[model samples]
Target: MTEQIAHEPLDVLRLRARRRQAGRRSFRQALMRAATGIIGEIKIASPSRGRLIDNARPPASIARAFEAAGIDAISVVTEEDFFHGNLALLSKIRRDTRLPVLRKDFLTTPYEIVQSAAHGADAVLLITAGLADDQLQPLLSEALEYDLDVVLEIHDEQELVRALTFDPSIVGVNNRNLRTFEVSLNVSKRLINRIPRHILAISESGLRSPTDVIAMKQAGARACLIGEALLGADDPRAFIAACRPAFVA
Candidate 1:
C-alpha cells in the first residue's frame, strides 16, 4: 500500500472544517469531570502486540460495547503498517457513537493532519519521537486552526519539554518505550506533574487494572488511553470499571 500524502491544500481543509465539521463532543469537558477518565481505544493490532481481536469483533461492534461501558472518549488507531487500522474505521466509529474520536497515528505532516480531520476525527495524536523541529509547529497550528484537539504524546523528559512549548490542551505520557516497545506504567507517574497545572495530562499504555488507574490519578493524570488489555478482555466493561477511580462528594 502506498503511503498517503497531503495533497489537499490547507485552505481547503480550513473551509471544509467550517462547512462540514461535526459537532464537537467536548473531550476537554469530559476530562474535567473525572479523576481518571478512560479514553477507550479501538485498535486491531500494534507493533509490540499483534492482532488483538482480529476476527472476534468488528470496529463498530467494539465501539458499541465501549458506548455501553460509557467510555469517556474513543481512540481509533489509523496507521496501517503494523496496526491493521484505517481511516475508514475512524469514520465508521465516529458516525455510530457520540464519543469524541481520536485519530491515534504517527501524524507528522500537515496532509495527515487535514486528512485526520476530514475523516471524522475530533482529536489527533502527535508523537514527538520522529517529528522534526520544523515540522512540529505547523502541524500543531493547523490542527488547532482546523478545530481539532491535539494530544501531545511524549515518551520522556526531552519530548515533554518540547510538548510544553506548544502549550497543548492535552498531554500524554506513553509508558511504552518506542525503541524496545516495552511498557512501564511508571513513565506516566514520572512525567505527569512536570506538566503545568493548566494542561490536561494523559497516561498512555501499560495500564492493566483499577489499581493502575488509581496510581496514575495519584500521580496527577486526568485520563488514561488504554487499548490492548480492553480489546483482549472477555468483558471490556469490567476492564473499564476496574480502572475508574472512586469519586466522593
Candidate 2:
C-alpha cells in the first residue's frame, strides 16, 4: 500500500478523489452538538504499545460499536507502518457507521489530502510538529478544497502558536510527546486553554477513565480522541458511557 501511495501519479489520485460524490458528513457539527464529544479511534496497533486489538475484530465492527456507544465521531489511523492501518479500513468503516470519520495519519502533501477524501474521510489530522511552516497552510487549504475538515494537532506551546497561524476550525492537543513517546494529560491541560474558545479544542491520546475525561473538560476541551482504553475495554459501550459528562445522563 505504501508503494502504491508513493508511485501513483498525483493526477490519477486527484481524479479518483474528485470522482467520489458521497454526501458529506459534518465532523464539526458532530462535535458542536454533543454534550461531551468523544471521537472513538479505530486502531490496530501503535508504536508505543504494540498491537491493540485482535485482527479478528474488523474495523467496521469497531465503527459500529462506536456508533452504538453514542460517540460523536470516528478517527481511523491510516498510516500502515507504525499504526497497522490502511485506507481500505477507512472506507469500510465509513460505510458501516453514521458518525464522521477522520483519517488520522502523518499527511503532508496535497495528494494525501485528496487520497483521504477519495477513501471516505470526512476529516484529516495534520500535526504541527511534523509539518514545516510553508507546508501547514497549504495542506490545510487542500483539505478544505476537498470539503474535508481539518484537525490541527499540536503538542506544545510552540506548535500551538504555529497551528493558530492557519486559523483552523479545530485544534487537537495531543498529550503524547512525539520525542519520547511519553503520555501525559498535563500536555492537554496546559495547551487547551491557550486556543481560542471559538475554535473547537480536542484533547487526544493517553486519556483513560471518566476522571481523565472530566479533567480535560474542566481544562476547556470540548472533545477528546480516545483509542487504547476503548479498544482494550471488556465493554466498550459501557466504558464510553462512563466517560461522558455527568450531566449527559
Candidate 2 to truth, TM: 0.94
Which residues of candidate 1, in runs, are more than 4 Å off?
1-15, 246-249
Clash pairs (backbone) in predicted model 1: none
Cα lDDT over the full model 1 = 0.81
In terms of TM-score, the best-performing candidate is 2
Residue 151 in model 2: shift from native, Å?
0.4
Q: Please give the CA lDDT of all the candidate structures.
A: 0.81, 0.87
TM-score of each: 0.91, 0.94
Model 2, residue 139: distance off in Å is 0.8
For model 1 the local lDDT of residue 223 reads 85
Model 1, residue 192: distance off in Å is 0.7
> What TM-score does candidate 1 reach?
0.91
Model 2 / residue 32 / CA error / Å: 0.8
Instruction: Give the alpha carbon lDDT tens digit for every residue of 54-161 in model 2.
Output: 868877887898789778899999899998999999999988888899999999888788889888899999999999989887888888787899999999999999
Tell me the deviation in Å of residue 199 in model 1.
0.6
